[model samples]
Target: MRVLIVDDEPLARARMDALLKECADVDVVGSVGDGEAALAAISEKQPDLLLLDINMPGLDGKALAARLAHRTRPQVVFCTAYEAHAVHAFELGAADYLLKPVRVERLRDALRRVRQRLESQPREPVGWLHARVRGEPIRIALDDVICLVAEEKYVVAHRAGDQLLLDDSLRQLEETYPEHLIRLHRNCLVPANRLVGLKTLADGRVLARLAGTDFSPEVSRRNLPTLRKLLRVG
Candidate 1:
C-alpha cells in the first residue's frame, strides 16, 4: 500500500518512515513537514494511507483533514505526541492513532487494521438504502449516483441507471453522506469515489468527471481545492 507521512518534526517523520519500511507491503511514498505540503503531496501522490500529526504550523492536521475530506480522503492514522485529540480524531473517522515515539508493534497493528478495512469494505456497493421517494419505496445505490441537483423545494437524485426525486434538500444529502459524497456546487453533490477527473473550462468554470459515466458536474470556485484534493489530483 502507498503511504504518506505528515508531521512537523523531521525526527518523527524519519522514525515513522523507518517503521513503515519494516513492513514489506507498505511503500512510503512521501513525507511533508506541514499541512500545506501534505495537501500538495496528497494531491499529487494520491497515497492509500496517511500518518498525520494533529498539531502543526499553518494549517493543523485536523483542519487539513477537514479541507481534504471531500477530495482524495485517504484512510488516516493519526500519529501525535498528545492524547487530547483522540475524541476529535475518532469523530473525523480516523482509522487509528499512535502516540509520539511510536512503537513498531503499534504501527504494525495500525497497518493491519488499515488493510482489514480496505479489504472488508464493499467499495462497489457504496452503501445503499431503500427509502420512500414520492411515497414509493426505491433502492438508492451509491455507486449509481451521478449527480444530485437541487430545486427550490427538493433535491433530485440522478443515477446512472435511474433518477429519483427526493423530498430532502441538497444540504441534507451533504450531511447524510459526508464521508461518501461531496458538494460540487450549491445545488449539486457527487460521489467522492466516483470522481475520476477534473477540468477547468475556458469560461473559468470547473467540471468534474464521474467514473463510468460521461456526466460532468459543475464545481464552484470556493470548493475547487477541496474537490481536487478529494479526487487526488492537484
Candidate 2:
C-alpha cells in the first residue's frame, strides 16, 4: 500500500516512518508537516492510505477529511494525541484511529483493518473514459459526466465544470452506462439523476431540465411520455 504521513512533529513522523518500515508491503511515498502539504502530496502520489494528525495550525485533520468529501482519494487513519476525538473521527468514516505514542502491535492492528477494508470493498466495474485534450490524455469519470451529445463523428461529453470531446459515439456511452444514462433525444443522452423534470413549452414541446443546472435538453416526442412518467410530472 502507498502511504503518506502527515504530522507537525518531526520525532513523531520519524517514529511512524520507522514502524511503517516494519510493514514490508507499505511504501512511504512522502511525508508532510501540515494538511495543506498533505493535500498536495495526496494529489501527486495518490496514496492508498493516510496517517493524519488531528490538531494543526491551519487545517485540522477533521476539517481536512470534510474537505475531501467529494472523492475518497485515500483512506484515512488518524494518528493523534487526543482520545476524545475518537467518535468524531469514525463519524468521518476513518478506517481506524490510533492514539499518540502508538505501539507497534496496535499499529499492526490498524494496518490489518485497512487491508481488510480495501479487500472487502468492491471497486466499480466500469473505469474512466479516455479522451485526448491539448495533446494529453484526460480521463473523465463516468459518474461526473452530465450528458453525452453526438456531433458528427465526435461525441461531446458535458461534465460539471468542464467538457471532453471524444472520438467515440453516443451509442457506446449508452451501452456502457445503460442504467445511469437515459436517452433524451436521438443525439443526446443525459444522466438519469440530472433529469429533474420535463418543462412543457407553449407550443406543446417539452425539454428536460437538469437539477442544479440551468441548461435543459430537448425531449424527443418518443421519449417525452416516458420521461414525464419517470419524473412523476403529468
Candidate 3:
C-alpha cells in the first residue's frame, strides 16, 4: 500500500514514517506538513492511503478529506492527538482512526482494516486504456485522459493534445470506473480530477471546461443539475 503522511509536527511525521517501515506491504510515497501540499501530492503521487492529522494550520485533515469526498482513491486514516473528533472522522469515511501517539500495533491494525476494505472493493482497471491510433494499437495512460465523449457508435478519449477512439462504451466505462469519470451528459463523461468548471453560452448551451484540454463537451440539460451539485457550482 502506498501511503502519504500529512501532519504539521515534524516529529509526528517522522514517527509515522518510522513505524510504517516496520509494517509489511507498506510504502511511504510522500510526507507533507499541510493539507495543501498533501492535495498536490495526491494528484501527483496518487497514494493508496493517507495517514492524516486533524489539526493543522491551514486546510485541516477533515477539510481536506471533505474536499476529496467526490471520488474514492486514497483512503484516509486519521492519526490525531485528540479523541474528540473520532465520530466526525468516521463520518468522513475514514478507513480507521488512530489516537496519537500511535503505537506500532495500533498502526498495524489500522492498516490491516484498510487492506481488508480495499480487498473487498472492486479494483480499478489497469492504468492504461487500449485504443487505436492511425489504425495501430496504442496504450493511453488513464492519468492522461481529460474526458470521454461518445461520438455516434464510439467513444473518444481525450488527452492533453490528443484523442483516441476506444472500443469501450460509456456505460462500460462508467460501471468500471465510477470513481474516475463523472457523467456530464448521456453521451459525455469527464474525468473527475480534470473537470474545471461549466460555462453557459449565449444560446443557452452549457459546456464543461476540463483542466488540460480545450475540447468543451456540451453538457446535456438533463444531467446539468446533478453535475452542478457534483462540481459544487450553479
If scored against the real structure, what TM-score would every candidate get? 0.54, 0.57, 0.62
In model 2, how large is the Cα lDDT of residue 81? 89
Worst 10 residues of 1 by lDDT: 122-131
Question: Can you give the lDDT of residue 185 in candidate 2?
Answer: 91
lDDT of 3 by residue, 151-194 (tens): 89889987656679997899998888886778988888876766
lDDT of each: 0.76, 0.77, 0.82
Stretches of candidate 3 exceeding 4 Å from the true structure: 70-72, 125-131, 137-190, 194-234
Question: Any runs in candidate 1 off by more than 4 Å, and if so which?
Answer: 70-73, 122-234
Could you tell me the TM-score of candidate 3?
0.62
lDDT of 2 by residue, 1-234 (tens): 889999989899999999999876899999998876776566457677899999986657887765454344477899998999999889888989999899888988998888787777643423477687986887876655667888888888887567789756888878877766789999999866456556789998888876445678888999887787755421
Which clashing pairs does model 1 show?
71-229, 71-230, 72-229, 72-230
What TM-score does model 2 achieve against the real structure? 0.57
Give, for candidate 3, the lowest lDDT window spanning 10 residues: 121-130
